[model samples]
Target: MGKTAPPSIVVVGSGLAGFGVLRELRRLSPDAKLTMVTLENGHFYSKPALSTALAKGNTSETLVTSSAEKMIAQLKLDARIGREAESIDRAGKALCTTGGPIPYDRLILAMGAAAYRPAIEGDAAHRAISVNQLDHYAYFREQLPDQARVLIMGSGLVGTEFANDLITNHYQVVVVDILTLPLAQLVPPAVGESVRDALASEGVEWHLDRKVVAINYVGDRAGYVATLDDGSNIEADLVLSAVGLRPNVALAQEAGIDIGIGIKVNQYGQTSDPDVYAIGDCAEYQHGISAYVTPIMAAARGIAQSALGTPTEIRFPPLAVQVKTTLLPVNLLPPARNCVGEWHSVESDVDGDKHLFIDDRGFVRGYVLTRQKTEQRVEMDTKVGELA
Candidate 1:
């Protein structure tokens, strides 16, 4: 008797998550009929590098590490670029894309996430830019002048990193956030204050506990006036929105798959339907969506195995996020959501600061390190165990 043929697997999206899963799948089952559909040009680049690209003098084209041709040939994939997966026909086991319907025995959704832009009442609101992809970065660079004043909304990781990068490039940066301090959700108050102060010392203005109520074109000024919640106004040559990201779950939800903050998936990356799966930013496991690269890479392997008929449970260890703010470098492992804990500064020396979140049982649940202390990231990771 002849050997049984491998199942056909269709993966949606071409971001790191999608590509990661494809790479793993090929490693596990080389002969599996694999297809990749994406809305972009299918060029592979490090998404995290986008935040620091300006300071590193990297253009959109230079940022691409691999072309679609290379990825397709290398992985032996039926690749479709500049196309979108419109919907999924669950019963037919097919993906309805702009190109055509592609049948698959197993489907993986790695659609990633989109930038969340706040709705502000004003004509200039449409002018605000958010760089979630290579093309968006290209447009942002094109609009920026040699010496520009940039107003950034949101003081989170993306916004803070861009602020630092812009400052390095000699642009005046002003950051406004509804939170009282930068990285309020990830870092302790002291660490956040230190970051805010360091950035301010480098000529970056901070507007905490405020929001941009409106943005208006300044008459004959070639800029916009951002009206704040406090009724003050900020004038800038450009406005950049780096609020956050929301997972792309519309397709899954429309397909009648279970949806939470993201498309809900089990440890094996299996969705409500065993044949269908999800990973990366689009997937919400037992805890929630792990949008960072580390977690995504870990999930990719498990997802690949499950798609290959070998079920594997994904386990994400405590992951540390390195904030790109070079002014006061930060390495943080955020405490679990709703964990009963309190953060205490364990050490503060010339090397920098370290804060640990200790649960009521006295176990270290999380840690934040600054400056030279960030080198302890690996040690801290081992101590923190699995993150929910």
Candidate 2:
């Protein structure tokens, strides 16, 4: 008898999810032939810092922690960088790329999400810069002119963060949104209002409950004219589109894989086809799912276990959504689900304020604490642990 042939796995989209899968799978089977395909140059870095770059006085070139060559050497796997995965040949177990078709025993779609650019009448505004990826940010940085007038669309977390950073960088920044308040859908009205107020105090102008109807390119290099829904207009040197994101699922959908908000997957990160899996921003979870970092880590752990032949079962635990705004002087953590609680706030000179969501059972499900009160984190954790 002879030894069986080793399985080959192909992972598409080399973002956090793809990198996670590769790293986990390697631990599971060191001899497993793994290949990663990416649309960009397949560099690796922490994306969380993208929001605070300008404020930190960091350039896009300096932000990139590692390049494709470094990642390839570190991961020690076959990598196809700077090439797009056109589609998948499931019947043949291959990924069609710009370079060529590569065979795989298992496929992982981690291409991540694309910025949702809405249909608005505009020449250059609609085609404005977006900071979703390092590449896009790099391009925006390179093309930025001296003392640019920046207009940003959308007032969600990313939108506000970028606005704050741009203001810190001495750019004339204006944020426009159709919502009555910023971070409207994420946090409660009161909390969201506070965030908007804080950002406004930092010199970020807001056009709440308004929309950009059209955009016009000004004289040769005179910037842009942004038309508003109220028949008003503003001129700017550049515009940033920070609307939202839609997962990259065309590849999986083309391969006849399940598609929901994103590529459908289970706790094990397994798709409809067991041999295929998806993760990260591109993964569509089911039943009161939270698309945050904690669940993604759990998905990676469970998927790796299965890939290693242990076939472990893992369920995502209730994790708080922590909003990192260093200027906020508080760590804003969202209230957990199934928590019928009262939201109360306690203020201290040491800690700006401690906001707690206490359940009927006298347990703290979640909390938002200011940096001044971060020392009280132990007490909050104890309360949450009781509920757990």
Give the clash total for candidate 2: 3
Instruction: Quote model 1's TM-score.
Output: 0.98
Cα lDDT, all candidates = 0.92, 0.76
Candidate 2 structure, TM-score to reference: 0.89
Worst 10 residues of 1 by lDDT: 379-388
| Each prediction's RMSD to truth | 1.3, 2.7
Candidate 1 RMSD computed on C-alpha atoms after optimal superposition onto the true structure? 1.3
Q: After best superposition, candidate 2 residue 346: deviation in angstroms? A: 5.5
The C-alpha stretches of model 2 lying farther than 4 A from their native spots are 220-222, 287-291, 315-318, 335-350, 357-366, 374-388
Alpha carbon lDDT of residue 328, candidate 1?
92
Alpha carbon RMSD to native, model 2: 2.7
